[model samples]
Target: MSRSTTATVARTQPKRAVLAAMLLLPALAFGLWNRPVDAQEAPVEIPAPATTLNETSASATAVFAGGCFWGVQGVFQHVAGVTKAVSGYAGGAADTATYDQSSNGSTGHAESIQVTYDPSVVSYGDLLQIYFSVAHNPTQLNYQGPDHGTQYRSTIFPLNDEQTGYAKAYIAQLDETGLFDGPIVTTVEPQKTFYAAEQYHQDFLTLNPTYPYIVVNDLPKVAALKQLFPDAYRDEPVLVGTL
Candidate 1:
């Protein structure tokens, strides 16, 4: 990382560290902390693809970067077919996957979520619907809501050519349908190494339900997922208990 980028991440780390500390006190966390609500824009329920896989196998992995992984992971964890939704770094080298280093914006990594789901229970296109809708805004370019930087970019890292075809077609469908006020900017890239984030970052939304950041930014996405796709919503979330 460049000297300037290192300085930027170094400056950001302390404040986030302090926030982590303050999140321990529930009463204080609720009373003292307040954040501006994200715009009231809701995830639009787009149409399921007319064309989809003729059949899905036992299970598959899909990695998506649509802003902060916390909300994305939280949203997918509530989906019925999703067995696991892990917060991680993708679209970059494996060695530079560490959070602090990636935050400097030189690693070409995006805060992403690796979801393991049963295709029989839910097809990949179903996951894409939730992703395009309640998971995160696909039109936000490199940022999602409050978070900014390439690390939080909107990207879809497909595991294979079939997955890539699905993502590309979906983006085209949404764009053609004019699902959002702005154009969709989500990119479909070949899947690369996905390094799981640190333990504290795992299951963050479930474990830290009352954390200020989760309350203001992430929880609502889960709520929206439940509201928008009631059939697929699961009351309990699959969480990563340890790193």
Candidate 2:
């Protein structure tokens, strides 16, 4: 079955029960049973952007699309100063933002997350640091891990001119670092509309922690965040449900 189809089937109660049972097995056995075919991405150690936004706002919003939003959203939700991390669609029209439509990969929409955060506690540059380092692999083109398509492409939708400059400069800085295996392919897309995904998709990683995809492809990201950014990692994620 395709990833999409497997995800759909996993949502059913029967499949979920089976998955929960699978989780009870020994760690090595469970891992062997559910290992993904695609090699997982490991967080990179990249430096802070030489340039950062000077905005004085109490809160700010940023949109990012890097492969599946499940892991992306999960990573930000556990970060300090992040008010909310919502999985959604960007780089396309509102009408084409639905998962069903975007899944076709021709709607020009990539699975994205709109992150609301406090600049005072965590500057835009800090968020950029977390984004490029642990959230997803920016070097992959039109895909990440087991997923493949334009909908999984790496991108950033800057909300303002300052953010635009910061994103572009940060990508350039990372490219110069030679930290990634390949050049960063993340695009800086501005003036795009961000439509929240369907209710079921919101907070998916937290709600479905035992799901095969979440376990195989996303949980490591949260672990990486805690290990790499202990000061910025929060024990209790600021869930979208509470926002």
Candidate 3:
């Protein structure tokens, strides 16, 4: 081939390579996006906690880490009695809580959400029921759907001894019934430091409903919450930063 033709071909090849990479940018941006074993994984309707704080009205906080906080936060936001749900990182140190750092899966931070609710209006037991049933898969060991890693593990970070007791009892209750085909692997972890994720991470599902990952993996979970617990599902989500 002529020298001029060789040079032209090299330049053309690089342009083609650039275009190819750009075409795959969407998938790259979201990271490993895995779908659950069953897209229609229905919520497990476990009995309400037999023991709960008798106080009919009071404010309380609960933190949950299951899969991606975007969907977990989204699910709780639509729950009737939850005042606010903020996506964040939990079970990790405060200094390593940034999203970019946590994404590496070595920061010991699991994507988590802080749910503030009026316990009087919605008991903590009710929240736990919804969490195990509708938020994400408890059988998933260290990941949820297309996402894999310890950062996506199913976990409950109870705030106190009472909350810890309730969580443990409920897991036992669900396990005995064989509610799940697989054993529930959710572990109760003591809260370390809950750090609110970046501004862009909060309220992501609500703002980006049509995004590919949300549509395929998360929207159905919300739909199940509405279908199974109509009384508890609210159409308008309670946003965190907004309140």
Residues 1-243, model 2: lDDT tens digits: 754455665343443454455566667537744555332377897899886579798988999999888899999999999999999999989888887788868999999999999988998899999999999999899988767788999999999888898899889889999988888999999999999987777788888887676887788899989999999999888888833
Q: How far does residue 206 in candidate 3 sit from its true spot (Å)?
A: 0.7
**Evaluation by lDDT, superior candidate among 2 and 3:** 2
Instruction: Sort the predicted structures by TM-score, highest score first.
Output: 2, 1, 3
lDDT of 3: 0.79
**Model 3, range 22-86, lDDT digits (tens) per residue?**
34675743442343435325566666666775545478899999988878999999999899899
Q: Indicate the TM-score of model 2.
A: 0.86
Off by over 4 Å in 3: 1-40, 55-57
Question: How much lDDT does each candidate structure score?
Answer: 0.80, 0.84, 0.79
Work out the TM-score per prediction: 0.85, 0.86, 0.82
RMSD of each: 5.4, 4.9, 9.6
Candidate 1 residue runs with Cα over 4 Å from true position: 1-40
lDDT of 2: 0.84
User: How many pairs collide in each candidate, listed in order?
Assistant: 0, 0, 4
